[model samples]
Target: MTEYGYFLSCEEFTPAELVDQARRAQQAGFTRLAISDHFHPWNDAQGNSAFVWSVIGALSQAVDLPVTTLVTCPTMRLHPAVTAQAAATSSVLLEGRFALGVGTGEALNEHVHGDRWPSFEERGEMLEEAIGVMRELFTGQQTSHRGRHYTVDNARLYTAPEAPVPILVSGFGPKAAELAGRVGDGFVTMTPDADMVAAFRDGGGAGKKVVGGVKVCWSSNREKAVDVVHQLWPSELLPGELAQVLPTPAHFEQAGKLVTRDMVADAVTCGDEVEGHVDTVRAYARAGFDEVYVGQIGPDQEVFFDAYRELVLPALRR
Candidate 1:
């Protein structure tokens, strides 16, 4: 059976709001939670980006549901060693209910430290090495490593979880998917593409969990919801590698101007029809995703959860 989850948008909400949402998600029958990690929101209009680790810690206390980073970048802004320590501590804090979802990262977040953005190939290699380093550190034993992109000398995680934390790698293309399959304990992506899932399995992700996420806007007023997404998350509709390469929120804002309300309406599930929400999630399940996380694009979260609890979720389960 596929697990259903809520996607927590750290970029758009405060930590307190996120914790509250987590509680509500659990109450609304979302079995898990996925939070995005970012140094900056995709566009300034979204206007918030909390430190994800701190939010995860609070989540450990606020809800019993398992939590995963929708995709954190261990290769850039922070060294792999620091990310490993943080992930290990999070697992311990969540009492083993944490999974680390990681990706090669975007310049919007990774370029903040004045480090030159590497090419995609270089980023992938760096990610593979970082994953290796993190896996070693999660063993709770002193670890040392010298790799192509990073080096760790006699580092250890003092607060490692009793069991190793599962690492879910995010991929957007075939190469990245293969990399995820080759090195990740599981796989994550935003689309419900069965061919992508098959590629992951064929590349060695067979038997691993396949996780996907979708963004929707649930409102009685469909046009208002479309407007909200158009204002807050137009970056979602940006084409190609723009999301991965855009260096700043301003750049995203500039590019996002091209995304119209019509595109968003066509792409995202908006408005109050329970059937639309159920069908959106069911697409992921039908594509063989083991887990699907749904996020309401704007502030209509309460309405979304209530609708899911009263109508959408039960239909999907049935």
Candidate 2:
């Protein structure tokens, strides 16, 4: 059996606008909401990265949608103790409706603080340590940690929720996935790729709740939707080695040329049409995703929501 729900992808809305979108998504029958938590947009060309925690706080009051950060970097840039406090407070504010999705760190986002991006092995270690710190702080007692990447002294969360926030670890590879299985109460990941799901289960996440999401261009006009998504998210077609070994965004941009509208459609269900979006979202179901979120890339979200509700959701509920 599969449980499917609607989630907002969130690139096209401002921090303030997110509250309204969350409200609308809930009204339209989406059981959950996922927001992209990014320190910076992949490039300056893609604008609108705001303080997401603040947005989450606002959404708590304005909408009933259960929330997650899709994934946050708790190891570097932000101290794990502080991240714990934020999650705890947010969880309380949402009436225990929030979950924390975490990742090691992304260079484009975490490297802005002049911290060296650690090797994958070191990052995996840092992630595990950070999870430990978060759990300690959530206990509502003083927490101290001295680790290779993070250190906190007598830090504690006073405004924690009655229940510790559920930790949903997100990962792309085996090591991180295994860590998530050991630490997370639930698992979160992007893409419908089954191998990634198997790796998470093998890593000890068996029977843990798994949530997944995908990106798409929402438009009634298929060609326009295709053009827009490809123009911005060309990273989809990157060859395996090129994505793994690339040193900078420039190299990424070069390999991104391999992306095309057809490839984007095949990998993700895209278009302004209602049928197209439903087909893409359902594909995640076929791949064993427990929850699949669909994001509308670029700004024009109101139209996307309306079309998705009228055309896509009705078909999906059946």
Name model 1 segments beyond 4 Å from true. none
* Tens digit of per-residue lDDT, candidate 1, span 1-318: 999999999999988999999999999999999999999999887889999999999999999999999999999899999999899899989899999999999999999989998989999999999999999999999999998788899998888879888999999899989998999999998999999999999999999999999999999999999999999999988989999998999999999989988999899999998889889999999999999999988887888889999999999999
TM-score of 1: 0.99
- Candidate with maximal lDDT: 1
lDDT agreement with native, every candidate: 0.93, 0.74
Give the C-alpha miss distance for residue 239 in model 1, angstroms.
0.7
- Tell me, by TM-score, which candidate is best: 1
Model 2: residues >4 Å from true position, as ranges? Answer: 1-11, 239-258, 272-275
**Candidate 2: clashing pairs of residues:** 9-295, 219-272, 220-272
lDDT of 1: 0.93
Q: Worst 10-residue stretch by lDDT in candidate 1?
A: 296-305
What count of clashes does model 2 give? 3
